[model samples]
Target: MNKFIVVTGGTKGIGLAILQKFAQQGFDVATCSRSQKDLDTLKSELEKQHSCNVIVVKADMSKRNDIKVFSDAVIKLNRPVDVLVNNAGYFAQGQICTEPEGTLENTMEANVYSAYYMTRELVSLMKKNKKGHIFNMCSVASIKAYPSGASYGISKFALLGFSKVLREELKKYGIRVTAVMPGATRTASWEKSDLPEDRFMKSEDIADLVYASHALSDKSVVEEIVIRPQLGDI
Candidate 1:
């Protein structure tokens, strides 16, 4: 059976790049996004362009019920996901005191809660096989604190700690967990920021790193990798 890779937020930006890379490499690629229209378009594009097995499920990652439904759909395909990439997230930027309560709550739900639910539900399939690679899409916000980035940073910081514990717990089962933290990435989220395009990293660049790191020998696992743009911090 062909290996399968599952990516969330696969309709656009970094998630889209990772999905394309996996498809090009002949992996059975499965992904989820909230927009059924976007998922349909992505399915047609990948099938036409790459001639590979690509599955897109409409899922709102922020909701636990949606993730459960998405996982059930993926499993019904009858192929175990060999890798899971938790890339579904949102961004909220504002001064701390001025930021609304909704902003903080939404950020936490999208960034942290979504990932926790996905991993918790999806691990059963991986645990049955006792072989899998799980990558959490963390950010520089995880490693370093920044001004006016409290809400986003808090969730990412929690993810970093969660990744560490997940590593230790899953290690015995032959599952490798990695936290990939990129300084700044030029995605829809970054576009909304007042920063220049050149001030950040490309989504494709991060996708390439993901592919390469996973290609390493099974005996050699990278627990965490932090990458920053050469120019400087945005």
Candidate 2:
């Protein structure tokens, strides 16, 4: 059977990079996003470029029902997903005290809650096969505190911890979990920040890392990989 991968936020940025890599390798790619138009366009572009099967679903990861629907669609398309990448997330910029009342909660819902829901649903599918790989797209903020980023950073921190605990819990099932912490990727979202694009890491770099890490023998796994721009110190 062909390898299958399910990626959240797979239409753009780091998620898009990962999806392209897998598609180029001929993996059956299934991805979800909140925009149907973007998903359809992405599906066509990727399918044309890679000549691989692509499944696109409109889903808001923050909604539990949407998460369940997306997961069910993926499983129905491919019985066993060889890999799951939780890359859908939101970045809310502001101080906790000054931001909107529910900003932090919304950030947590996107970054933390979505990861929990995706993993919960996919892990059950993996359990049936006793094998799978999961990659959580964490951030450098997951490790350090930054000014005016209380909510976003905290959410990533929660996801980092979740990834670690899950690695330990799912070890017995032969399912590998990896937390990919990337620093300063030059995505459209980063344009709002003051970071210089030329000097920072790119989404393709993270995509390459994902492919390489998953290529390792089943006996070993890299639980966490923290990547940073060589010019930037974290």
Candidate 3:
């Protein structure tokens, strides 16, 4: 059976880049997005270009029930999951004092809980096989707090912590976990911004790093990576 890779929020942005990268490498790719139309489009595009199987599902990663349904679908494939990328997240800019109630919770739901629930559901399968690589899409906010980053920063911080914990816990089982922290990536999130493309890192750059990390020998693992543009955070 072909090896499988699962990615969340893969219709566009960094997630889409990772999905395409793996598919190009001939891995059977399973990914999800909230938009069914986008999912269909992506499935068609990838299938047209790659020989590997592309499984696209509609899923709201922020909701636990949706994740359960998505997880069940992936598990049904019965292929060992070679890689899991928790890339479903959003950026909500607001200060804690000024932001309305539930802002923090909502951000946490999308950025933190989504990864937590999805991992909890699929980690056992990885454990059973004693081999897997998990990537948590963290950010520079995880390490340094900035203005208007209260809620989003908090969530990424929690995600970084979770990634670290998973790395330590899964080491004994031969499972590798990595935290990918990229600064100011060029994605839909910045589409409206006037900043030049050179000011931001490319999503494909992050994907290349992920592919390299996964391609490394089984004896070595890149636990954490912080990638920034040449000019630095914008």
Best by lDDT: 3
Residues 73-149 of candidate 3: C-alpha lDDT, one tens digit per residue: 99988779999999999998799899889999999999999999999999999999999999999999999897687
Model 3 score (lDDT): 0.93
Q: If both were scored by TM-score, which would come out higher, candidate 1 or candidate 3?
A: 3
**Lowest summed-lDDT stretch of 10 residues in model 3?**
141-150
TM-score of each: 0.96, 0.96, 0.98
Q: Distance (Å) between predicted and true CA of 167, model 1? A: 0.4
Per-residue error for 223 in candidate 3, Å, reads 0.6
- Please give the RMSD of candidate 2 to the true structure: 1.3
Model 3: residue 82 alpha-carbon error in angstroms: 0.2
User: Candidate 1, residue 2: CA error in Å?
Assistant: 1.8
Residue pair clashes in candidate 1 = none
Segments in model 1 whose C-alpha atoms lie over 4 Å from true places = none
Whole-model Cα lDDT per candidate? 0.87, 0.90, 0.93
Q: What shift in Å separates residue 126 of candidate 2 from its native position after superposition?
A: 0.8
Over 1-234, each residue of candidate 1 has an lDDT whose tens digit, in order, gives 667999999999889999988888888788999899999999999989876888888989888889988888888886677899999997777757888868878888888888898899889888898888999999889988887788999889998988999999999888999999998888877655787667888888988989988888878779998888889677
Error of 2 at 109 (Å): 0.6
